[model samples]
Target: MTASNHPIVGILLLAAGKGTRFTAAGGEGNKLLALYPNSNGDQVPLLAFSLSQAVASGLPVRLVTRPDEMEIIAMAEQFGAAVTLVASSGSGETIAAGVCDSANWAGWLIAPADMGWLRSDDYVQVAAALSSDEAQARMMFDDMPGHPVGFGKGYGAALSQLTGDHGARQLLDDTKLVKLAGHSGVVKDADLPAQ
Candidate 1:
């Protein structure tokens, strides 16, 4: 059966963070809105690059962003993601909103929007692996945990009830994980310009 025949494992692209660390470190504005180099070395908005990767997964993508981020909203729409606006910029809040918005989906792959280094194929592979299993999963590159963690269908309520900045870390601790190795980009994020 094709992907459509299976229950959807939607991508919950989290983009509502305040990015205090980035800005405090001398990065401009919302880090997601800052221009960053893509794999091809072309400059594009950081969130746009991450959204591109998530959309390329061929899974349904629902992005949670701040209402003030019009540029990020436009980029998400352009990339074909269903957008949900949240007042709070907390990571947990963003995840909850996105997961609740996509509540009917069979599962969710929660991806941070600042991780511009990720490739489209990374999302694809993670979705594929998660679809074949019941356990939660995460990508590990060079033995380091990374973004776009996969939570199977069973964790919807726990995920929806999440709050604060701790975005799924506690819930993940309560469950077993299936770690898969992938490109080093999984461990890279745009928290700083040099990173």
Candidate 2:
């Protein structure tokens, strides 16, 4: 059976937090709105790049964003993604909203908005890891933990309780993680402009 036959593993995109660092670093409004080149050389919004990758991975997606982010929310909905407007700008709050919206999914793949370089293959691999007997899967590159972390059903309550800048750190640390090692792109976050 293919992945479509299995229970859906949600890809929750965290887009609510204000990108203070990114904004201070010269990025316009939401860091997500900035245009960046994609693997195909197309200039797309930063969040669009990541959302496109998640959509290509063949997984369900839920987006947690601020109420003011109508543009981003509209774009994500265009891809058939569920949108949850969050009141707080904290990473944890954003995640919990996404998680609650995706409560029906078999597992959860938590990804941030700024890590736009990740591709469909990365999302696919992480989903595969969470589909198995393992309770959780954390995407790792060069031995460093990164986004798109997968959480098994056991993490629902704890994940729902998350509410600060710390998204899923505590929940992930408490679970037995099946590290999905991959190319360095797994860790390529758009935190700073490429030189």
Candidate 3:
């Protein structure tokens, strides 16, 4: 589809996961709720920071979160994102929920909520690349794959069928993925309090 003729490419922010690993690794409470210092000298919640960046990208955003996450739901709504609630705390479930919630979009840029360090420009750059390319694309940092993975409209069904905790790893391996050089923050995640 032509760039102008194509449907809107929205951002799917996955925030439903339990972040059990982070807590198991000694992190306190939910990792998404943990405060992280931003460049503005303010400590912001990880998920809130990530959602802000997604909103700043100038694209429609859909946030998948748990029903109990009132703070996250409020932050997402404040950012004007369409929120979808899921009972299971799984990446695949979150992805499916977000995709199903915004199924009318032309495509989606799936991003993990833990990657709070990614800037708005990063999302814009990846969206631009995905819009121009015929195949799916993903951010690559120092030869490693990164998040905000872009998928064309053709893969909507496959993305929606996702389940369990693997997210879209299988789709990435099965599709024609174009790798773009994303900033270092693409590879960064709030896995620990010190990070």
Candidate 4:
């Protein structure tokens, strides 16, 4: 795709975090590497599923991962994403690195790496909202703002200011946010494995 199509919104898929919870649950290594059973009853790599969605989205995608995560970086590259290796800093730093040059796009879509179950078209819908007049937008599932949050170019400074676990949430205050209704995948995130 040309820059024109992706000029509206770029996808920032954060994957640098060490999945401590997953490791604690008797699952070794990164939770992203843990095999999860899919709908078809076939085990799939969590990161791979997530990476494939970002690739199928057709948006200009950047995968932010730790320098040690060579496997994840390689997989991300295979899916046609610009992979960026960070210092394994906090979530905020990972995001900042992913959107280092925000001026090229109208907005940035913050998609967490663990949210792989979201449908491909969901990415397209969220992106469409960014190109509109909305300065900031997010998926609304069950009456709450959820993941895959899209922030317009006007919030570039705030985005850049992110440093810890904080993300675009701080900027939502006192601002009109466009909420697009989405399914469960919009809010679903892999925190701890199921009991």
Put down candidate 4 lDDT per residue, 45-160, tens digits, no spaces.
78778878877888778888899888888888888888878885588888787777555777888888988777667777877777553467778799966778887787776677
Give the per-residue lDDT digits (tens) of candidate 2, residues 56-143: 9888888888898889989988888888998875888888888787777788888887788777887788778875534788778889
Off by over 4 Å in 4: 1-6, 101-103, 132-134
Candidate 1 or 4, higher TM-score? 1
- Please provide, for model 3 over 77-170, each residue's C-alpha lDDT reduced to its tens digit, 9 standing for 90 to 100: 8889899999865788889888888888878898888898788887777777665424588888999999879888878899898999898888
How far residue 21's Cα lies from its native spot in candidate 4, in Å, is 2.4
Model 2 clash pairs are none
List of clashing residue pairs for candidate 3: none
- Each candidate's TM vs. the true structure? 0.91, 0.90, 0.91, 0.89
Error of 3 at 6 (Å): 6.7
Residue 112 error for model 1, in Å? 0.7
Where does candidate 2 have its weakest 10-residue lDDT segment? 186-195
- Best-first order by lDDT: 3, 1, 2, 4
Global CA lDDT of candidate 3, please? 0.83
Q: On residues 52-171, what C-alpha lDDT tens digit does candidate 1 reach at each position?
A: 778877889888988988988888889889999998657888888888888778888888888887777777767766754366888888888987798888889888988999999887
Provide the RMSD of all predictions against the true structure, rounded to 1 decimal: 2.1, 2.5, 2.8, 2.3
List ranges where model 2 is wrong by over 4 Å. 1-6, 131-134, 193-195
